[model samples]
Target: MLDSGLKTQLKAYLDMLTQPITLVASLDDSEKSQELRSMLADIAELSDKVSFDDAGSDARTPSFDIVRNGTDVRVTFAGIPGGHEFNSLVLALLQVGGHPSKTAQDVIAQIQDLDGEFLFETYFSLSCQNCPDVVQALNLMSVINPRIKHVAIDGAVFPQEVEARQVMAVPTVFLNGQPFAQGRMSLEQILAMVDTNASARAAEKLKDKAAFDVLVVGGGPAGAAASVYAARKGINTGVVAERFGGQVLDTMAIENFISVPYTEGPKLAAALEQHAKEYDVDIINVQKAEKLIPATTPGGLIEVQLASGASLKAKTVILSTGARWRSMNVPGETEYRNKGVAYCPHCDGPLFKGKRVAVIGGGNSGVEAAIDLAGLVAHVTLIEFDNKLRADAVLQAKLRSMPNVTILTSALTTEVHGDGSKVNGLSYKDRTTDQIHRLELEGIFVQIGLVPNTEWLKDTIALSPRGEIEVNARGETSVPGVFAAGDATTVPYKQIVIAMGEGAKAALSAFDYLIRQVPVDATAAA
Candidate 1:
């Protein structure tokens, strides 16, 4: 049943519908179907612009046919669109109803300019916040271009297909049945992957290429900042990253970034790239740096090898590879990862709105996640293995202040319990009593720790025990002309703002190293 509050909101969104949108739900003997039919009818009553029609098709029982202005749009939903997935359904309808897709002008033009046909199989969970953004992006591309087809399948509703794909996460996009992109992505990023020969472009640059003054690795806030700062010095600059947004894409809400009081992960990440692109910096996305080779001399060219057989040569290298959310690695955690288990609260919390969810970890990240999700979800359960909460007192106070939050200290997460299709609950053992208990919740957000992206540099550079690259106050690594920033370094903090500051410092430091010491013409640039 739709809540009065939610219905009011939906009505306002539907009021601006440009074209008549029809939702046809085929009724079946099952109660779920009957309920879906009733719900569809109720939704249609919200506005005269929206209508409902009864259909007879039962191939995917209780499936709906979404038509715009009497013409069918290829969008289909195999299950009832509820919980966190509510936005996905609304956005899909809005797309079909003639609402312009929310994308940059250049991006839309690029999608329209695409040459060949491509099939997109996007696997998602109803309760993932990041899933909707990806789905909407793909859906928009398909809607704007006849050659592109985007099929969004709910991982929870189709476990067999998900298992066959060996999917351990949500928001995994398979381009023509091959895993294309995983995790959260922006429209600009999806365009880069699907638009053209991104690898070829990188290769072209690597050939007979003028050595870069500074090369920023990792495309997160730190890397973007470094690229911009380096380019500002009026020298050749380049950035090669696997993903532009990095872990920022995996994040949901960002409340602390200094000047900006509030923003989402993808939004902030987009801004990072947008600002960096304003500079004369070469950005190579969708590529990983496999190895880092230092120069033969103080001012010689440093070589960066790529996974695509492409190599980048730069005077200096700034490492901002960032880090990934730590997984619990327990049973069912992987198989039902995207189905019900998630890592980023900001990215997937909305999918469980008004539903019970749990946050694992007692540290700042977990506590912050619980605080954030409590506002959207119905209830919050904080699970920590230690007896005492490890978060700051202020955070602990804030969490304790919330009426919808319950803290469970001295508890060990044993297993993620879920049906083959989706997560239904979890089991934990009480550290004090040694008694195992099961929790019934729709989602689990793991925030235990972060694993740095510095493994590739372990043998090459001076690293801390945790594998984070060791850096000085100036963001310089042990290797000369090499620097590190953000979550991949030994920076005291891992916040986005901190990373940006570190990146700027690293860029300035690199510039200082060049002008004061390194020669541009000697030793291949020495």
Candidate 2:
């Protein structure tokens, strides 16, 4: 018999488990039966806005509908919305209810009087936890106002939608029937798009024209490098970034970059931007490139359109958009990020010197990070879902030899334990033994993998099945005069040096394409 308070809490938790609970299906039949009844009763007490009538046998297939005021906001709670995903869902529900936060409300108030409707559809994969945050922000907008309709489609479940949308990655947001933003976006950023589009529509009423020579789409290391290189070559280059520095800005430090022993990511990014400015590159910070179209001219020019309704014409286009880190969709993860939770060991490892930490993932990156951190941190606990580490035997032997490193095979992070401000430990389940254990740690590093920033280019360029843009050895894409470099391209290793080298290669290729235009006699004379 369970204590009354424990039973009530369990019932509340079960009620929230809309789907057939496969997550704990391993429990004895009698216990499962009792819990199901308790959960159902709890569900009956909640408002009519939520229902679990069609919950499938699989825990991942929990179907539920949200009815607000008189409007139905259909939603399916599949899997556990833990870690970054939890924050994402909350924001999504708020959006569905039209309850915008003060910040969002102010932004909304600025554009609510507009006459046109803007619809945003976002597709996301569960593996990429960052997607949920962006989706939730968009959902909040939808709830506060009817003019903005927001729909979030889980890529794994909606195969047709994924294929139709050409969603190559998670958190791809489409605005006004066209793919608008990719990856995670802030509330202010999305609102700015609405403001920009509205203003653009009004500008169209007045009629205007804008143009440039070269337009760099991203502002990370690659994009900044491309802009600087293009400007140095005397091309009228313009760069538009959702936020300057792209994903690298989130990273704390970068030690792999050549020539520099070690430098913080934000500082490096700032220097790069300054260098590009010195070369006369026009940079528009906080602006997003919504779409790219071929130029009307025959000189291999391209037209870049911004979310703000402004457009620029360029003789060439270079996509240096980098990749984003993959996240664990477990509970309590996002709440602790950067506060004892981190993604880059090389960047944040030193910060945890002499402190206990956990590294999640079975792949080479995970093993490598654990091995490296063991040398710095007091102890390292490596957790992998698979039975074995996927690292090279040599590295595995080295890691195993480290007395301070503990390996937990077939373990999955179920929840991150923290003190609201920082991570204190983690709870995980052993797949083979069905045992749950919580281990204390001062920091957690997630090295699962990376997702390229290439979804928006699905219809615009050729991409590898892995979603990375396919590029030739020269960094040229299938589209002539259009090139991609860095993690966004099909590069084997994602390092700052590699991205920078690729950016230089792409710039030279673009230059070659331009120099060919010189007259035959003039070229011979030079």
Candidate 3:
């Protein structure tokens, strides 16, 4: 099941096991079960402390559990944990074998103290770039506290279970047999959901924190750059983000980042967080900013209010709160989200395998999504609101070459159609013909564009007509000590490289503003 090279690498990782562990598997005579058994055998041969055993049950065939010896700590995998989930399987084995985790001590303590029996089941696809984070986090939590049991189920492997649950998106997690969440979630985010008083406790801790010299409000490529640059200057730098990787975490492939030939979004995001941590930067994850308050006096502290009822004070604030996927605001769109409407083809495409689906929009993202979906789905209908395709010529040519794709130009999506449980079709109107048509499909992938995450700052600062933060060449906004960068600002092209450059520029501009400061009137600073 594993190549010789892979076996050698697996052996090295298994050698780090501090205690005996067992691979308990439930199997049938199916081909996948045979493959899984072979893989388990290969793994058991690599380490003396590792062993394989039969689960002695006929439920969820081809599934296995990594259990620590002489303890109840274990995590279950209900299918072949390959592709993106390979890392998750490896981490589960190591963690279940008593290998130390790099999670914060406080977070670990919280996980260990959680009460009650919480059963979590996550439906995932191997092609999903976001599924591993959810799977790995739950696996680690299950290993930490046996009462919190988790099973990572491969939706592609069990089609009946996927249909039964009406799971149209990847990484859809169910808690205690009820829908908990349906997207990429961090460990901290999961804790906040299950633990009742987690937000209040966090708010109390954040309220008592000291002020910072340069406090970054986002944790994307731009925010990471600003934090590193500020921390290198021997200043108190801190970063607060809903997630450390922002929109970059959802991106599948990134080839345009300079000097890097090719890299996935999650990998690059992890590297960015690690680089920032190397300096004196303090990162606070899973925190959302609700409001921004400018300093009442020049050279005074600027305050940022969070949704958790905590406020952070800083000398200068850099707003790099990035953009998010734009949604089609038609009827039934919100009601059927995650039920049949999805924005990420890379993450949710496999769930619609062999089913008919529609790709909304005609730009690069839409065309690319159609091209990718054509391989997994039975047929793809591409809808566009323009008279012609706006995608690159190469992409257009490739998309046109696909035999199962149908393109509709000058068409506007009007409403999503669902059968109370999941999407069944959609309605669109042709601009040239003045005719409305309904197309039968099982899923809808909306890839129109991005909307800047600047709604919270609408009344606090000067913004452009399109709702983007207005800034000068030096990244200075209307407010003297408040600056903005990345896609949230009025910057032209929204690219990763450009965002990094803009972030570094904003950090330097903030530092320069701090040095050349005068105790002028608050009105002057404004």
Candidate 4:
């Protein structure tokens, strides 16, 4: 039974906690359960203040909510908040309490004094095990400035929400309702995006416009190479991409990419972007092309429209949009992507060095990736829906000789199992025996195949039955002024070197078309 006086004091304390007051509580074995209940009651009381009627059964446990008082702040918690998160919670309370350390205090002072509100959401997979660092960092920021609020979501636990955001990797952070960063980012990088958002908002008020020439749609090796070459040729080249690195950014290491004996995908992509920018290539990050239409004049010009309603006109266009990896579309697959679920072994295999991994597919790509991963990872389990591997005989023989590779033919991956962030294991049904068994592994790589990003070009240009762009020997597409290269085109092989060579060929072809339109004297000099 509780006394009226104690209940009143508890309610007051809850109000204070909700408003920038900090409370730290520790418990011993005998009082642990009771202490937890008391703390939960306090949180529940605060929930009532914020109009959370369904504060639910676990009021003491960490949850999510949006509080708006002229300004809106989204608050969320990851994990139980009883261990490392407890201290983090305390700091968060202190910061939100309106008192913070010198560095945080300064930033908060600036933010709170601002007129508009900033909303942020961070997504993480529980299996990442490294995502807690990001949560703690954000908690510290929240303590310094209440204006900067965050929502932390478990990628695996929330399928619908994760899908809506199109979260392909863990530690993905969004600011002002837009994707700001992905993977593990430092505190400075996170803050920088916040600053950028603030500046962009301010610029929007000013209403300014910018233009460019030769806008490349993708930022893969092919696009990066094209941007570098085009910018050097003095064309106002600009590369707009949803991500800076394209598909190769997720790769682990490249032993086969010429000139670079060994390199990670992020490192390689960074270098490519840097080199292109040095030549004055305007690289626009986090932008997607909504449509590509022919120019009204019909002089081989293209009008590229962005999802943001911004448009650019280019005398010539290069289509180097690469392919996306095929997924299994199984229940747990989405939740575990990049956690225990992967699409490219060459991109993530080194991270699982000496650990067990599963390769799903039996085609050439699957066999090749499995063979490559076997050299680094401790064990490789190859699961194929078909009864046999479709790889070349020599490659199959090599895979067979490798002691770490195990082939499971006529099998299907039914479900992926993990806590939430990473894959701990998976279950598969053997077609031969009609028995399902779970295999323990640290990762699962999906190497089914690649699908071209040419779906949008079906009506705009000619496409092969496989959805790849139809290009001539000189890399000219069926359209007069448009050129296609890389994996998106009808290239026999999909290799980085091959893509680079094709991009160069396409650029030369575009230059030839340009020369034909100019006067003979000017054309001869060019």
Candidate 5:
């Protein structure tokens, strides 16, 4: 199934290998084994620096051992790496060829501090684009800390293991045979879970009554930036978030975050957390804000109620609750989510490699998703409800340039049809013809719009009809001493760079408010 064009690409990537590498496969006499061996031989033929061989027969399931430069770096795959996993295999080969792991030093330090015999059993499917991220991060961790050993298992190749673990998704990391993380995670997040002593720091019961100069709600890009700014002013800063990394954790490819030309979601999230933690900001992760009450008196503490049943008081508050992807409320859409219907094209598109898929909607997001998927999947069919596409002319032109992509305008999706276990096809109607059409597909990606996370602030702060928090140029909300930023706000654009700027402004405004307040002791002296 390795196409000629893909072979050319792999040839180029493999040419970068600075050192000789060998792939030793322990295979049995089976069709699947033979296919895997053929694929490996094809890869080995591409570069003179690379070679592969079968090391006789082993009783256990097939395994691969990658050796480089006369040393066994101990890189291995538990099963045949196929589908999107082909890329993972290539990356592993490069790493073993002496490519330096680009993980941040701070993160590596934390990994080194971790003590224990931890086995990272990561289960993934061949097609999951997100799986490579988690696998790559874990493998780097294993390289850094000898205490940690990682094995990337192809879930499809190991049915018995999948059944025993009750595995239903890709990129599932089991720490010591217990599920630790279910989706794409950053190196920092994985380390946090592994370091029991470090996790204990956040396990302390939140005080029912607490105080701060500034309290930032939401732990996404905006909240991370805001806390750093607030803490830099030498003021008491605290951040309470439902989860750190916000919507970024769901993002797979990030090419538009400015100077950084490229980055994955989980890696960026880890970096954001690391950058924020460089200061004195007290970040409380994985905690939701139940309620918000603005102080009636000036300089009075703004009370924030957390889901943990603890209340916090702060001089000012910054809301950065992020938005979530809008889902198409059609039959089988919910049931087949992750089974084939997905939202993040960057994260899940690769899983559909060599399989046909459909993109729902015709807006910028939908078109962008189609364009991104066209490079990975076998073919892409974009279905739009409108008479004309809403994406920019440039994007439309680029999408049209792809040979494997087809666009259907004035098409309304009626429903999603799926097999008992996963998605199989899609149903839609042509507006002008009033004729329904069904296309067989392995996956469907919905990219309609976004829903802001402002429901909890109802009646307490001004909100747009779409429920986004209303804010001024200075990031001030309707409620005094309360500010908002990021996707949850009425910001004209929802981008990481814009969110970070807005967060900085909110922190500065909160500081302005704090300095202007008269201390109770000063009032008494007066």
Candidate 6:
């Protein structure tokens, strides 16, 4: 099932097993089951501590469980965990084999302290870049606490389950047979949702932290860069983010980052976090900033209030909150999200296979989604509000060449139509004729653009008309000792490399501002 090169790599990883483990598979006379058997056989042959067993009794065929020897710890995979989920499978094996996780010690303790039983089922697609995080997180929790059982199911392999559950998006999680969440979620985010007192505990911990010399908001490319730069100066640097990767976690292909020929968003985000950790930066995750309180006096500390009711004080604050997907804001759009509406094509495209769908934009992301969907879905209708497509000429040409794609320019999406359970169609208006048309579609992929995550900063700092934080050439905001950078700022061409550069510049500017601040006593003496 695995190639020679893959076998070699798997063997190297299998050597990390510190304890004996068994692969218990439930199989039937099917091609997928045979393939899974071969893969399990290959895996068992690679390590002395690993063994395979076919005496499994799971009702779900072509599924397997990674069980630690003589322990209740077990994690299940409901399909051939290839592609993006391959890493998830590897991590499960290692964790169950007594290999330590890189998760923070506090988080591990929280998982261990959880009291209730949690049966989690995550529906995922193989091509989804976002599914691995959700899968690996739950698997880790399951390994840590025997009461928390999790099974990562491949939606492609279990089409009937996907349809019955109305799961049209990747990484759709169900806890105790009820819908829990429907997007990319971090381990901390999931724990916060389940553990009722997690926020209060986190808030108390954060309130006791010492003030930082440089504090960065957000955890995308820009915030990561700023944290690293500030910490390298031997100052007390800290980063507070709702989620460390931010919008970068939702992204897929990233080809334009210079020096690096090609990489994915999640991978780069991990690298950024690792790089920052190499310094003295204090990283805080899954904590949203709710308000910005400027310093009361010159050279005073700036306070950032978090949604968790905790406040952090810093001498200098760098706002790099980044951006999120721009929703259509049309009727039923929000109501049907993850039911028939999704933002990521690479992640959720497979769930709509052989069904008619529509791409709601004409930009690069829209056209690219349409092009990609044309291969999976029965038909793709690309709707654009402008008279002409704004996508690059190359992408437009490629989209036009697809026989299953239909381009509709000068069209505005009016509303999404659903049957309460799922989406069935949508209505759009023709700009020239003022006529509205409805298309029968099983899914709608929104790819318009991004909006800065600076809504909380309004009236606190200068912001552009589009809600982006306004910054000068030095990356300093209108308020002294508060700088801004990245997609949330007024920087043009919001690219990752540009964000990193801007973040670095903002850190330097903040340092300069700190040193130049004359002491109150010194000014009085003068």
CA lDDT for candidate 5: 0.82
Candidate 3 Cα outliers beyond 4 Å, as residue runs: 329-410, 413-447, 519-526
Candidate 2 wrong stretches, greater than 4 Å = 1-211, 253-267, 290-298, 305-312, 518-526
List candidate 6 segments past 4 Å from native.
329-410, 414-449, 521-526
| Cα deviation of 308, candidate 1, in Å | 0.8
Question: lDDT of each structure?
Answer: 0.82, 0.69, 0.91, 0.68, 0.82, 0.91
Model 4 misplaced stretches (Cα beyond 4 Å): 1-146, 151-169, 172-213, 252-264, 295-298, 331-336, 346-355, 371-379, 387-405, 418-422, 432-434, 492-501, 519-526
Which tens-of-lDDT digit does each residue in 317-371 have in candidate 4? 8888888878887777865765678776655677899999999998888899989
Model 4 error, position 114 (Å): 10
Mark the 10 consecutive residues where model 2 has the least summed lDDT: 19-28
* TM-score quality measure for candidate 1: 0.67
Question: Any residue pairs clashing in model 1, and if so which?
Answer: 84-351, 129-348, 252-346, 519-526, 520-525, 522-526
Between candidates 4 and 5, which one is better according to lDDT?
5
* Candidate 1 displacement at residue 427 in angstroms: 2.6
* Steric clash count of candidate 2: 9
Scored against the true structure, residue 48 in model 5 reaches a CA lDDT of: 92
**Candidate 1, residue 135: how far the Cα is off, in Å:** 1.3
Residue-level lDDT of model 1, residues 294-372, one tens digit each, is: 8887678889888767888988899999987688878888657667788878557777999999999999999999999
Q: Evaluate model 6: give its TM-score.
A: 0.83
What lDDT score is found at residue 246 in candidate 3?
89
Cα RMSD, model 2: 14.5
TM-score of each: 0.67, 0.59, 0.83, 0.62, 0.62, 0.83
List the lowest-lDDT window of 10 residues for candidate 6. 248-257
lDDT (10s digit) by residue, model 2, range 285-308: 666667778755446458777666
Question: How good is model 5 by TM-score?
Answer: 0.62
